[model samples]
Target chain A: MSAALKLVDAPRRSVALEVRGVSHAFDLGGKHLPVLDNIDLSVAPGEFVALLGPSGCGKSTLLRLVAGLEQPDVGALLEDGAPITAPDPSRILVFQDPTLFPWRTVWKNVAVGLEARGLLPAHKQRVADALSLVRLEAFAQAYPHQLSGGMAQRAALARALVNDPHLLLLDEPLGKLDSLTRLAMQNELVSLWQKVGFTALLVTHDVEEALLLADRVIVLSDRPARIVTEFLIDKPRPRRRDDADLVHLRQTILATLGPVHD
Target chain B: MSDIAQGGAVRTVASVPIWRDGVAAAAAWFVAAIVTVATPDVVPWGSTPLWAEILTGGAVLLLVLSGTVQWLGRVGRVVVHYGPWLVALGVWFAVWEVVTAKTGWLPKPFFSPPQGLLHVYLVDTTRLGLCVLFSLRLWAYGFGSGVIAGFLVGVALGWSKRFAYWGMPILKLIGPVPATAWIPCTFFILPTTFSASVFLVALASGIPVAILTASGVGSVNRAFYDVARTLGASERFLVWRVAVPASLPHVFVGLFMGLYYSFAVLVVAEMLGAKYGLGWYLQFQTGYSAYANVYATLVIMALLTSGLVKLLFVTRDRVLSWQKGII
Candidate 1:
């Protein structure tokens, strides 16, 4: 635990992850299906960035490219000034399904990413600490089937954090939860980010969630998607949902997204 | 003052005694026995004595009585547990005895009394045991090989698009052909009778399993694979650790089906060519006109098939316990 604390003292001021003119497409029966178009973004060390868009706008695609799950057809993504060509444990992605191995209990599921990277033995304490941070200590031995949606997502978060990834990529991690659970998880995520001080890049369609959680929200255009707008939230930590300033920001984003009835 | 209580009690009185069904059944049996004895020559088969005829009638009556009791006592847990099984056994024995002994539809020399068959079973326990052991050995070898080979092939085909595209069509074309049809070719190609049996059973069983495993692999959530890829899992880890584990429920279903298929194919294979095993013993008994032994062998095969199927279910429960509600 103290060793992880050492990361906090390491200049806390360098660029953690960078996306430079990254673009991607899929092969659709000899036709190019453009997904993300020349997306360029950067997140400073310990900054929380959100890529917000409508469905099929390739917010998730951008996250995948940055995480190095899919190589961009053009340009490059870099982490700590190194060119990203393949996935690395330094950038871990938290998925919507929690995707915890059903056969493994909560503790084992959290430990898998570390184990996959061959870091479990040295980081076992860190894993436990992360699980405790998620308030899942009592459910450490419970199977994924036994967990509610929120609990499973918490375990997924714990798994990503156990590796002490420099960039924590979230692909709509709370999108599947009910409204009440989603709000609670949003608060938990922001608080955890504050405590851990890790750089985060979240992909979400919910404008409010993006406004509440991100330091900067990057909105993408529909299909052949590219960055369309960027908003910086200057509100202080633990901002309330009912905060007038936050509501104003949300309305501004909705306006940028276009007619709500349509 | 007590007159009202007495009137109410009379209104609430129970309908009949519990043994009323048994009593009625006994009377019906007596009538049937009288009719059967009076017309023995006209009976479908005349081998059974008048006394045996009466006993068979009584057994049928008892079966009906027990069935009625089970229906009436459906709410009672104890009756629910044991009643249906008792009635089923009684009915089965009665029908079997009547068909073979009281009816001449079957060849006379090839039929035996149920008591005579039971006596032969108890007396020749050693031979029966040996036959069971031989049949089980073949079953185990064939089923085990089929399941392992099917899962391996399934995973390979599932993990790679290239493999699936080329291999799946070929497997589909060949899978539907019955295993029994391969007996003649195997007889000449294989060195031993048992090897042929094993090979035929495995071939028959593995096709369905491979198809099932591939389908299972194809159905794994695309998101999970993306997550694995994003997490920096190697290609090997993705296939074995992620893809295979994800597709396990499908694999189990394939294995279960394979087990049953192998057992059926094993019997057919053994009967056709093998020198030893339950199927061979059945053939030998039929040729010698020992109809009771043939019936006994058939019963043994049924029991073995049921036991093996149960074992498959138990193994499935253990392996896929993770997938209880996921489907």
Candidate 2:
């Protein structure tokens, strides 16, 4: 698959987002409980990285820290050598649910981040281009209620893309989708990433999804989660579902997570 | 020529009615008239004439026939949907007229014969219209300000837990007190009677809006806020754009409830001090023993309340159309 895409020879840029020695916890009724402990990660510009772990492994916490939605108690997150203090338009997050505003049409939802940034005049064409890229041009004027689950997620994706974010954080964005739509969106996401060349950090419990999408997969341990292992996919864009090497990697990650004995 | 074509034509043709609905209506009217005429009242009937009885019976018949025609699809869809209700209303009017005219349980002229009340409705249109306008103006002013303030303060309290913790208790302490309870204080604090009424109405309505909006904001999915944060929405944007919209459905519920309270409070406030509102007219008519006018005012109040609610429903449908099939 890598040979077919021939992306390996393409010039790779420096890291667009970096996290070092980050830790986070919550004060639950006066008792502090740690969630993520001593995390370190880096994403080169145009790279696709996946954080795969069990339900309580705090992969989402790591993504939030990098997105500036939450602050790490111990360490720093940097974008282009500058520390990130708050959320910026250069980092966009997509969630498991579409989370499109119920009052807005698809076009308005896609344009919301730009509108929020007061960049409508400067980014109007970019918004339309992003929607077309997601193949949702026909649904631009349709409200969220009029869209199917798959279409709504695509709109959410378009909304994230329109800003041309330097870092894209996906927190189990496909977890709620049906198996077929999940597979289809996984392909769409990979192609979009390749074309747009934005760095991506996806968090998912599905080992296969991680292997199929990410250039690098980071596995995390249980509560007070820390990085347990990292595996490089070495596969290419438009990678096959049944690729022998990808299947092997999925099985390996599954075994590392837990036993399948019955 | 073909069996399928013949069957379709037959189905279409079979849909028409064989008899005119007016025949059935006339039969029902004839029976009612005969029964009323035959059953002579031992006591003197109050203010009801033979002509009025006949007219009321005919009106009932007309309503029933209209409903039947609608149900049979001789008319359009809206008529068919509202047909039974129209028929029920006609019957209700007929029964009320009969009971008031023939029965001794009600005082004379207090429950004015339906004809007299109807006459008041026709003749007093100007007075009724003015009262409706007065009430609606108060409603718009109070309800609008209440909803806006509720949403803003609610979002503020909802976003910060510390604010919610301190503010919620204060709100709870004050919110349970009815809006009408402040009427006495309003009279003293406010100089003008109309202004006082509006103040009472707004205060009464605003409390519920504030409480409901806060709770609505509190109930927003935390994950959604996280999404907004990641998208780089500023605190102001998060509250106005994300939190407010997300909590709108619940906020609407509060607005509706507030509208109801506003109407009730407005009437009370007006009756206590104002000189020109519907409540004032109601009190004046009752004092003068103008039974017909009193009933007319009561009818007007019912119409205004229901009409305001219907307007809200239409606005809600338009604004929240995106939530179709969701809630």
Candidate 3:
């Protein structure tokens, strides 16, 4: 109900994201370990895209690059045609863990971005709006430990949403959640994106999840990952997991990732 | 993890009925009072009418509290918790009185009855009061300045690698040496004995805090820093908001250690060249072998130090309330 939360009908200024020839590697005790291979992708403003890959296929590393927490060694990431150099409040990343500051309450955790930018005083109401957006208003003062897994993840989402980010990079944000919570949050995520209209790039290992949530799903190969295939899902909002088309897409995507051991 | 089970567990811890422990405590205290008044000392240690009165009064008060404490709400809960301790204290007091004054088993000058301690309290209240005030003043100044300096130095060492590179080796070298070991040098360096004593207390307290704080800050989860950075937090923000809060549990560990060290150094330092501290009073009384005064001062010192420790605990609970159940 707060002013910061735009109605679904209202126009939102989400940013266009461009990743060009991005390649990155980590040094593991003096040995070169490649994670992300040369990868190029672009997301339209207000679009929802999911990157699907095998576990440890550099999907999260790619999200980190897009978040500007780390720079890709080979290429540039841009937001709205401007090169991403440093982490900005406009581009927020939600990790697998809630990572809520244990010392802070849910409300305080959500206010971190605004507080860090010195804008909390002027926009305190946004924190409350963000909490309620994720249906966490009743637990605004509760500590992270007091919250259930789903509630804590919701609080983490609110922490990102409070900044009114243009692009949200989700690095398997619901990976640690139970299946029931994950399904509920997947619906919540879709509705939230529709309402806030942020350009979202989600990195997920679940093919069904990618198929269920994203307008477009980009599949990458195993470690030193490069884009292997892309799928365009024209399904309507509130798409069902069992829908024939989604089931077909899931199977095809899984097939492309090669045989699953599990 | 089940809330219902946890609630049941709590509900099962039933409060003692009829206040049996309280009654026992009152009975012991009454016996102590009777023995002090009715029996003559083996060697007429001192007239202790006031001590007898106090014991009688305490017994009567305990008896009354036993009857009425159930109606006192929160205070009653606290009384119930310490019921066993109260009973032990009463029994201990009676036994102590019998051995020292009634039988003279623990002979003169070497040991005194409880009332001999009480007699010291009644006669030398002014001197003890002055000593208490002076000791507290020195302790406050030393502990305050030392904690502050240590916290700053620790933060610097923790946050900046450059600072740690130069500071850590020096800290390792100096930290192990006893604060008292510097006493001779400190007296020569500082202009006054008071300053020297303060310096010793500060050194004893500061080193532990600095060492623990540095380690605490160093060991904070790196993920927290990453999370803060991605949230648009500045370098300063990361250090103050993320690093400091995350390291607080460790800092508190340091603080507790510092508190104990500070107290030990305070007593030792006061013994050196002070004019009017509890430590000074202890030394002065011992010189004359006024064992009664020394015993009374030791009791006061025990109460003061424990009171400070309890105060620190209260402060810690308030500051770290967020961490109540989590860690």
Candidate 4:
């Protein structure tokens, strides 16, 4: 608790992200299949933004480009004023599957970032702090296979947080979770964002998830994803699902997403 | 009153040692000693008195154990579990003695009585010991070098596309051919018979490990690489820390195959132009019609091979402990 309190006082060094005229496509067999088309977006430092889209709208592709894992066919991604060319410890992406290294204990998995950067010797305490942040200290010695679904995902979050990443790219990080765990984790994510104050970009198919967590929610069209609309969620913290304004926003976003096609 | 009576009966039963199997084993051994001492052999075999004395000793030991085994705890359980086998072994020995030595039904210079085997052990201890040492040294050198070279080749083939392209076809071509087939060429090509024998063993052991390890490394999930990369892992870290550890289960499979293959090739390799090995001893004894020595050596080979296989199993269980529930 003291460490978490100390983190609030530590100056936040979050960077503004800019995606300008970004377009990407995949070569499936002999044909070119476009995924993202001419996307222009800017995120303020320390802001919480969520991208809401259909199942295959290429929202995840945008996150990968920002992470510098893959380059866009056109245009550039900038971190502050500098171009993002390759993956750096300052930016971390968490996937829906948790993807914890199966061989390592939960503590070792969370310590991976620090170990990779050769900072583990100096910043060992950060691993404990990160585990405590996600309330996984008791399970630090457990393997990924031994953990429950929610605990595994929390361990994944702790793995990302150990690096003190300036930008967290969440590609449907909570998509695979059950509804009850999803609700609890959404609140935990809000608390984590408010406490640590890093710029977060989440991609989710659920409109309510976007409305509940994000400061700004961007919706994208299907296939070759283009920005359809953006909603500013100016609700206060601890927003209720039944809040009249959030309900109205959910209904509007759902209508725009078109009839539920399940 | 009835409950108290039942509890007293249970207590009395618990206090009494269970001695059924032990008594049976003791009787069998006693019979074996009686047969060895009372019946005259169709032909003379030395160590007959010593063998009878050994059987009587085993009978005495079993009779003593039946009265005391309950106090031995864990060891007592193991003794009880193997009690039936002990009885069967003693009966088997009595029958074997009657057929081979007492009746001469199995004939001489072909099948030896247990006493004949014991006589060979007493007379040829020095030569047998030397053969065991020589066989172990050749096995160690061939198996060690084969596994190391195979592991390196497997890693290279799995990791690099260019290496796989050049190496895969060659490996596939030679992998199915028996290593003994190369003896005809290796004997002429290599300067020494020792070198040729070592080459044959190495080839037999190395191929399976290479094939299995390469497949193991190749089949590792690609998502693991992606996860490691996003965590700021270097290429070296990805290979050593991630790829290598992930592929270990497959490598172990390869190791087990290699171990068995090496044993097979070692015996065959030793049979061809080998100076001092168990296989050579077998050939030399067969030439002299020393079937008793051959039987003794075969028993030694069985114990050695099975003991090595058990050692491999223990090592696998220790190294792959993390894979317990997952597998």
Give the top-scoring candidate (lDDT). 4
| lDDT preference between candidates 3 and 4, better one | 4
Q: What lDDT does model 3 reach?
A: 0.89
Candidate 2's DockQ is 0.59
Please rank every candidate by DockQ, starting with the best: 4, 3, 2, 1
Across B1-327, the per-residue lDDT of candidate 3 in tens digits comes to 254576755444344456888898899899888888888888776656777888889898889888788989999989989999988888888899899898889988889998899888878999999999999999998999899889889988999999999999999999999898998899889999999999888888899889988998999888788878888999999989998888888888889999999999998889888999999999999999999899999999999999999998999999888997886
Model 4's C-alpha root-mean-square deviation from the true structure amounts to 3.1
* DockQ score of the complex predicted as candidate 4: 0.68
Candidate 3 lDDT by residue in tens digits, A98-131: 9999999999999998899898898887887788
Which candidate achieves the best DockQ against the true structure? 4
Which 10 consecutive residues of model 4 chain B have the lowest summed lDDT? B8-17
* Residue-level lDDT tens digits of model 1 in A139-230: 99888999999999999998787666778899999989999999999999998888777889999988888888999999888888888889
Q: Positional deviation of B189 in candidate 2, in angstroms?
A: 2.1
- Model 2 misplaced stretches (Cα beyond 4 Å): A1-15, A258-262, B1-75, B80-95, B102-107, B122-126, B160-166
Each candidate's TM vs. the true structure? 0.83, 0.84, 0.94, 0.94
In Å, residue A65's CA in model 4 sits off its true spot by 2.0
lDDT value, residue B180 of candidate 1: 84
Q: Give each model's whole-structure lDDT.
A: 0.77, 0.77, 0.89, 0.90
> A1-262, model 2: which lDDT tens digit per residue?
2222222233434348878888889899999999989888888877889998889678877877777777788999998888988877778888889988878889989988888888776657777787888899999999998898999999999888877676788999999998899899999998888776778999998888888899999988888988889998887778887999988887888878876311
- Which parts of model 4 are misplaced by more than 4 Å? A1-10, A260-262, B1-15
lDDT score, candidate 4, position A240: 99
lDDT of 1 by residue, B130-180 (tens): 988998898778877877788888887888889888998888888888888
